[model samples]
Target: MSLFWSIYVGVLVTSNLGLAIFLYIYGTRVKIPIEGDGTTGHSWDNGHLRESVRRLPRWWAMMSLTSIVVAIGYLILFPGFGNYKGLLGWTSEQQVSEARVANAQKLDQMFARYRQYPVNQLAGDSTARQYGNRLFQDNCAACHGTRAEGGHGFPALTVNGDDGDFVVSTALAGRTGVMPPWGAVLGEQGVTDVANYVLSLSGAPHDAARAQAGEPRFKETCAACHGAEGKGTKALGAPDLTDHSWIYGGDLASVEQSIRDGRTGHMPAWKDRLGEDQLRLIAAWLRYNALTEREASIAAPVADARR
Candidate 1:
């Protein structure tokens, strides 16, 4: 802290402590007027309520004194009064760093066996998956949902399950997917027609006449990236529009907005921060979770039939 702030804080703390001490001492010792029959002259409420004084309870006084002592001790041992640094020279930053080191040491022991196995082999281990899940929640849960279900513009991790190779590679090295804005190129009506046609690909509710008008424009303009069939190209990070899963949305309005405004998504690389092994672990966890979800979805109908 600056010199002025340090002095200001010190003064405030000291003044408060001093005032408390003064009050405690003065309150116990000060004498009050006592008329005959051991009552002060003060009276109220038709003389029913009369002011009376008594000595401070020994227990209460002791407790207050003890609290003052504890407060002084705390100030002496810890950094409470601005930048005093305290007698113990302890710091919150130092404590955090020490905790992190201890945690790393514990994790090193756990990950020792994992180091022996390659990422592909590690993907099958339950222990690795658990650790990977923790890492995912810590790092990737903000963009991707806690369950990896994806948010607004973020792509769901479970959509394309391919043993996690592609996801892991993408994680280690960041990738950017850009859908260039076409509002300027395509007029308002043209954008709406294209959106309707895009929605029609997935069998969503759309005007057939509008879709028919939009198909020719889509083939000429969007075919390069989205493909003529509108299934999209995975190699280019272009999403498959034919599927039910939509990143922005599958609705007419949302689709129109996407066409007009376009969208850009970025997945930052974690190689330098998380290392290759950690990335592999996270990828394995994602793959395992996706497979679990897929299996449950398939079993739901069978279970319902059996019931």
Candidate 2:
């Protein structure tokens, strides 16, 4: 602290403590005159009640004195009185540093054991998944939903056929997908037609005539990134239209808007924020959830058939 602030704080502390001590001593010893009724003649409620002066209870006085002593001891031993370093020379920063070091050591031991198993195998371990779930919630849950079901602009982690390696790489390095604007190239009617054609590829409701008209244009333009089959290119982070998985809505208007104005999706790198082992844990949890969901999806139809 600056010398001025340090002295200011010291003076304030001394004054406050001195005032408290004076009050304690005076409260115990100072005499108050009482009328014959044993009241201090201070009336309240139109004299229905009168204030009474009694000695500070022995127990209360002792407790107050003890508290004052404890406060002094605390100030002497800790860094509460101005800029004084205290007798123990303890610091909150030092305490926090020690705690962080201890935590890091524990984490090192835990990750050491986890390193033995592949992420796919680690996904099966309940303890690893628990840790992974916490990591996912803390870091990944904002864009991807709690269940990884994703929102309008964000792609669903659950549906993507990304393995643990892909997930880890993408998370560590991040990825950006750009869909260039085709508005000028395609024109207004062309944009609409191409959108309908794109919808048709996904088996979504679209005008048949428009879809037919736009197919040639789609193949000529969009097929480069979207693939000839509209299945998408994983290397480029292009989304599969055929799977009916739309990062930006699958609706006619939404599709038209995307083709016209274009879209950009960015996944931020977690390399500095999260370590490789932590990322692997998250990837494992995501893989496990995806597999479980896929299995459930396959079994649902079988169960329905039995019914």
TM-score of 2: 0.88
Predicted model with the maximum TM-score = 2
lDDT for 224 (candidate 2): 97
CA lDDT, every model vs. true structure: 0.86, 0.90
What stretches of model 1 exceed 4 Å from their correct place? Answer: 44-50, 117-131, 178-264, 272-278, 293-307
State the lDDT at 179 in candidate 1.
92
Give the per-residue lDDT of model 2 (tens digit) for 1-307. 8899999999998998899899999999998999999998999999998998788899999998998899899889988778998999999999999999999999999999999888889889989989998999999899988988788889988876238888889999999999999999999999999999999997899999999999999999999999998988878988888865688999999999999999999999999999898999998899899888888877987999999
lDDT by residue (1-307, candidate 1, tens digit) is 9999999999999999999999999987888879996778789999999888688999999999999999999999999998899999999999999999999898778777787876667668898989999999999999998988887898877766435778878888888998988888888999999999999998899999999999998998899999999888766788878866788978888998888888998889899999777887888888888788878877987999999
Deviation (Å) of 201 in candidate 2: 2.4
Cand. 1 TM to true fold? 0.68
- Pairs clashing in candidate 2? none
